[model samples]
Target: MVEESAPDRTTVATVTRNTASTITAKFQADNSEPVENKNTWGYVNVTEVTDALQDTAAHDVCAPFNAPVPNYRAPHRRTIQVKCYEYIWLIKYREQTILKNEACKRHRLNLPKDVNPPSGERYTYQGEFPHMGIIGWKDKEGDYIFMCAGSLISAKFVITAAHCTNLRDPSVEKPTPDIVRFGDRSIVPEAADAEFTVESKIHRIIIHPVPNYRELYRFRLTE
Candidate 1:
């Protein structure tokens, strides 16, 4: 605690010491005649600091952690990199004829079922072959003429061989192919086709102009 009071020619309140007291102490420090000890009384204190080498804040601190750790695995190191490529040995493989995934296996096993039949053979149900289709047109005499077999892929389309139309009906002799028949397992002539039988109208038939495969001959067959 500091005392703030009127000085009796001495005391006062201040954070710094009095300059008069410092001057009085200096006067008493060397009371001998000024010229008598001139060689021992005064000398300049020399201090040289380069690049903060003499930083007084860390005077006695041993091994200060001021800088980041050095990275020995830095990219600038040249010999740390190595490159070599060796001959690879590949394992033998077996060719697969039919690849059946879980989805395909499930679809094959879980076909739609018909509990009761309206007509024809219910035991040998056509639901087992629901996607099968027969594409044909009626003749001019009203007699039905079957052309090519196809797969009823959707409610509106059937996929069939292009040769069925390309080579056979060259000049558009038949009527416009408007219907594709599916599930045509009619055991009796008078009975309805099948419980799953359906006929969908064809808007148009799109066939790829490119053949899937071509024969190559070098005096020997190779595939």
Candidate 2:
């Protein structure tokens, strides 16, 4: 206690840094006889006041995933991994190095670089023998029966054998050749390029006028 009187009291306190302290003072009153009053006290100094935090948070943090590098190759369909637990289909395109008969050279993989392509008589590709036409006949069931093959000489006419146009079958009218389909590779089962084929009606058949050619198979043009 610095200054204490009968009715009042005063006290001063000092605190050091990085330490804790407290202040207290005594009070008294001049009564009829010896008397005492309320005492005053207060907390002093301080430890520290701040949020509970860390300068650098420490935990298990995974980095982001990166796309895998691609290994370039020829045209094909393959699977690709885009993300974790995710996959996708990828189609790569390249030059046309395969014939229609051989969809790919996978059979000859790892072969010599200077080796020739798979050797076989391949003919049924696009734009191959485009002038060839199919000579068919409509039967009683409205189905076209492929009879013979012809060649298209012009846009409106096809050249075929006269015997193909004859109703040789013993039925009422044994399916005479009356239809010609051009720009086709298959006739019965319909090839993959069937949608691009052109079909036309036979307006008339003209057989060349030759002596003794009535029963003989000869070339004829149908308009």
Best-matching candidate per lDDT: 2
- Could you give candidate 2's per-residue lDDT for residues 1-223 as a string of tens digits? 6985553223222223112221112112322332211121122111111111111111111111122323422122123212211211111111111221233222224334465544884435445688888877777776776768777777676776666667576532354676787776555443324656777777776666662333333233444
Clashes of each: 0, 0
Candidate 1, superposed: residue stretches over 4 Å from native:
1-124, 167-176, 186-196, 211-223
lDDT of 1: 0.40
Q: Write the per-residue lDDT of candidate 1 for residues 74-102, one digit (tens) a residue.
A: 23222322110000100000001011121
Clashing pairs in 2: none
lDDT, residue 176, model 2: 60
- The TM-score leader among the candidates is 2
Candidate 2 deviant stretches above 4 angstroms: 1-122, 170-175, 190-192, 211-223
> What range of 10 consecutive residues in model 1 has the weakest lDDT sum?
84-93
lDDT of each: 0.40, 0.45
TM-score, each model? 0.33, 0.41
Worst 10 residues of 2 by lDDT: 48-57
